[model samples]
Target: MSYKNILVTGGCGFIGSHFIHHLLKKYKDINLVNVDLLTYCGNPENVRDIADDSRYNFYKADIGDYNAMSSVLKKHQIDCIVNFAAESDNNKAVSSPVDFARTNALGTAVLLEAARQAGVKRFHHISTCEVFGQLPLKSKSKFSEKSPYNPRTPYNAAKASGDLIAKAYHHTFGLPVTISYCANNYGTHQFPEKVIPVFAIRAIQNDPLPVFKSSGNKREWIHVSDHCSAIDLVLEKGRAGETYNVGTGLEKTVTNIADDVLAILKKPKTLKKIVPDRPGHDSRYLLDSSKMKKLGWKPKIKWHEGLEETLNWYKNNPKWWQPLLSRSNSWK
Candidate 1:
């Protein structure tokens, strides 16, 4: 079923903004309503180019605020909701666990309830691979859809709670819902705080790339565009009350990523420095995305090519990232 009026929470944020742009370009008759709180990472510049489109509208509101979300849904006559709003930073979540719970967990429940009450056609929840916790450094096993939730960080714990709540809403209330857990995403317009952007920017500036102790910590990586495509597929064909994992099946370690970035920029490998690992740091994360693949969705971008394109983006767009440097300090 094709949806006409869609409410995309956190539309001004990285992945949400990209998804909005993709939808606007792909569907001519669809109307999109973007709800974003414009937090530190949510920058208006991300979607400023599409701000004036007749079919697209923007609302400066928090999804956690039930009254605000309700008003927007009613005002827009929304039929479908793609939820991307949450406190997603691991370090920040450790420092402020309450904020994570309030946003990732409580906020999700609030939005789910609102969607149920409004009779929205479908509620798609965007989640993270961290909810399955880490795998042994030398283990070959990957986390599948049936993998038990074993969140290690405050951020993942909160996201896990949100996923469970979404499931509960579907089983208990029969509200149409689908959940997707995705691997680490890297692409253009990403905030400099994330690993890819941070390393890219630091490499370009000849700054030391900080590697956590035991740089062998591995993560599955996927381009933001691929992740968005998977989400769209889930919204269109995914069965209600089902969970799908999305990833490229490619894995790289922290040191390997940093080295690759430096190599792409023709910089010295000596710039890599080992630093203390963050609290509750996971050693590795791997996902088995066979479920999403069976749904006719697969990642298109290879890590090396995507990494170069992303590095070039950061290297060329100084104005977009320069202003955010002061705020990004806290993330470091």
Candidate 2:
């Protein structure tokens, strides 16, 4: 797909900012517009370096607002649309499923309609492996594109609904849309509420890292940069109406990941406090990103190296996270 302009929703957030950075560096000819609601987790400072670029534009808009999003699409002449905007906190979803449904599901539908009317060439929707719900450790299998919908959390359920909508858009209207389901992403610029960053922030503050389960809950880990690369490949070359899984295929226990973080911070792993697991916490989840690998996309940063680099970024960005940490309840 030959495209000159791209529209990215939620560009100020974790994966979206990384995607913007990757796009700007990889393509000099394309113009990029980022639309985000600037929610608590969404920080514009994450994109301060690129805010001044002539080819970059940021719109303080919500994807849930159809009229506003349509106007932005018409104004920007967006050729490609990547939807990453969502209310993505598990705790928040538990607290407010209606909010999750509105943003992740209804908002995606609104964007799909806008993209269709704008005659966008490519529409890529970012999704999560959590949509597969919890896989049993005894099963010893990874979820593929063919995996059934078994969402266990409100957040994943909303994402699954969005995925279904995207698929229907392609099937019914012939809208050019591709969906990418990805594993857990960790890197710099992530809000500290996430697992890795939360642990890093707590460790920095001399607080205990909260471990919800026995620490044996298994998960697939992938670097955020690797995920951005995979998304790029999918946006550029992925087949429409197809779903691709993106991950490093590196599986590790939650306990081991926390211990690894402590090791990187040069702190003892003894600060881990086991707590009652979250309601309906999935025991294990995995993804088969072989389809993405077949498209010539593979992870560059190893887990150990990436984890250390993420730790150091948090250490240096005290000014960036200080205010956020003060208001957040994760540490307490």
lDDT of each: 0.91, 0.89
Q: Candidate 1: list runs displaced more than 4 Å.
A: 330-332
Error of 2 at 272 (Å): 0.8
Q: What overall lDDT, based on C-alpha atoms, would model 1 receive against the true structure?
A: 0.91
Best by lDDT: 1
Which 10 residues in a row give candidate 1 its minimum summed lDDT? Answer: 323-332
What's the number of clashes in each of the models?
Answer: 0, 0
Q: Which pairs of residues collide in model 2?
A: none
Q: Residue 77 error for model 1, in Å?
A: 1.5
In model 1, what are the clashing residue pairs, if there are any? none
TM-score for each model? 0.98, 0.98
Error of 2 at 123 (Å): 0.6
Q: How far is candidate 1 from the true structure (C-alpha RMSD, Å)?
A: 1.0
